[model samples]
Target: MARLRRFLDRIEPQFQKGGPYEKYFALYEMVDTFIYSPADVTRGSPHVRDAIDLKRVMSYVVVATFPVLLLMLWNTGFQANNAISQMGMTGLDGWRNWVMSTLGIAHDPNSVFANMFYGLLYFLPMYITTLVAGGIFEVIFAAVRNHEVNEGFLVSSMLYTLTLPPSTPLWMVALGIIFGVVLGKEVFGGTGKNFLNPALTGRAFLYFAYPAAMSGDAVWTAVDGYTGATPLALAASGGIDAVKEAGYSWSQTFLGVMPGSLGETSTLAILIGAAFLIYTRVANFRIILGVFLGMVATSLLFNLIGSDTNPMFSVPWYWHLTMGGLAFGMVFMATDPVSAAMTNKGRWIYGALIGFMAVMIRVVNPAFPEGIMLAILFGNIFAPLIDYFVVQANIKRRMKRS
Candidate 1:
């Protein structure tokens, strides 16, 4: 550790102002700060200092995602292996199968090692594509704008990769991330200044632009020609009965053993991550509580107004909590500090809006079964207005007291 620090210190002058590599200072600083905390400090008065910096905050989020990441790998492989077994095939027809065969790993769903390893093959490629494509944009923007490269992309890339279907094309992965970083964020002034979540922005672009690839029964499982509807999609079509007929129970959905997007499937895993974030104060608990209450209230209302036509109207609030990306988005996306409402009271409104809209879209709109992505984006758009009203109300109350 000492040797590495000394090495960085020795080469620091070469990247400083007026040096030959001065233009690449952003690149240098990115690597340096990533490995060690910055040496620079404020010397002036009236500056409040804290032990936690941006890097630590971002790193904590990445760390919190560990439980979700593990489940994503295990569940992805389990689904694929289980599908292949049902199809009566020995293995897939590509390199993945070849590697598994050489490694003596069978297509057995019960084998924990086999499931995780097989899932890694699917996950690693997409993650690498996201990192390379998104990192290039981050570096380019930092170099052009003459600012230190922010650590936010680390979180964005991981979150975006988790949202994608395992079989998503490598090219589409690159294109989606590029669109996300450039338009969703950079166009609005990057990272903390952006009004939208960059990860969701790119995902939304792909959802609209390439609808066939993004959704439907074919995309969830990695095996080609295997068609399986997510529990939420099943509920959308045949109500809770359809999901049960397809062999998905509330417990299965809750544990995330069923088919869906990689990280979004497991409510248990998402909650684990949420607990850590809330404990560390990285995520706002009010927003989480508000989202939960709003979802329960709306879902219960729909249940009361039972629809003879739409089965989705019968889904209970607890089922809604376990299904799809509701839990995942409530914990991660709605709590984004920059995009969420700033005022304390506004956080409640913002979260409720997301929760309400998510259920509304899932039940009322037959076209789209899952609604968290659109709901969070909607909340992000209205966050500023929500905050504005909150501020005005507070001012009026204070003035009356005076």
Candidate 2:
């Protein structure tokens, strides 16, 4: 602690006003404050006694995401290793397979160690690319605008990374984040000021800008030349039977052992994170409940109106909860405090709408199997209006009482 304090103290002065590094104060403060709480405390009007600050809030969300990130690591490795082993293709995977084979750990997706190892191999490079590219853009924006670097990027970058396919190219990761940070958030004045979740904005950009790279069966799995369709895709085409035929069960999907985005595969993993966030009151429980209720109700409605042509109609409510990005988006993306509805009543409406829309899109939109991203983005766009109506209702009630 003393060493850190001393180091901060020594470097802090250089970035102070009129100092040699004053122009780079934002950069210095970002790093220094991340390691140690800002010496500057709230000192103005409306100040209240609270130990928690923005850093703590951001850190809490980051910490909550850890379980998903860890699971994603194993899952990323598992998908790649499984593809290699299942296809009996050592050389087909090219050099990665040859190297793993040489190391005597080739093509063992079930091996926890091997999976995690492979997962790390894929995860770190993307994460680093995200941090470096995203961080560079962030720094440049902060420097140009002469504004303090928003600590929100710490959370946004990770959230965006978690939502990505493991096989996403490094350039796209950089491009998406840059688009998300700049146009999505910064143009609106950054951080708490933005209406959309910056991370999701970047992801949406990627999905639209590079549809071929972002979607399709070939992108989800890490192993080369192996295509695995997400359960949502299978359900869309042939319903539940197709999923069963694809050799995946509801249990495995619920457990998050299926192929999908890096951190979006496991309902269990996401729920674990959700429990932590909800327990800490970091996330709104109303939104979570609304989403769950909405999905269950909508999915059941679909089940009742079974389809002969589309088997997805036969998929049960439980399957809806487990498949695709439902749990992940409900737990993380939909609950993003900045973009979600603010009013208590609005939260229910916002969350429920996202849940309902997600299922509707997944079942109906054969071209886009995962609807969570779009649903949440749709909710973000209407959050203000939802809150406005709630506020109007409250005003009318107050007038009537008067």
Name the top lDDT candidate: 1
Poorly placed runs, candidate 2 (over 4 Å)? 1-52, 91-104
**TM-scores of the candidates in the order shown:** 0.89, 0.86
Poorly placed runs, candidate 1 (over 4 Å): 1-52
Model 2 RMSD, rounded to 1 decimal:
5.9
Worst 10 residues of 2 by lDDT: 42-51
Candidate 1 lDDT: 0.90
Q: lDDT (CA) for every model shown?
A: 0.90, 0.85
Q: What does candidate 2's lDDT look like per residue over 1-402, in tens digits?
A: 899889889988899999999999999988877666677732221102123456756877898988888888898898888887778873554555565677887568769989988888788888888889889988888798877775678988898998899989989999999999889888887666788888999999999999988889999998767898999888888888889999999889988888888888889988999999899787899999999989888889988997777676778889988988889889988988778998889999999999899888888777887888999999999999999999999999999999
The sequence of per-residue lDDT tens digits that candidate 1 reaches over residues 32-136 is 876676776222211012235677568878988999999999999999999998999863689999999999999999999999999999999999999999999
Write out the backbone clash pairs for model 2: 239-311, 239-312, 256-266
lDDT of 1 at 75: 98
Clashes of each: 0, 3
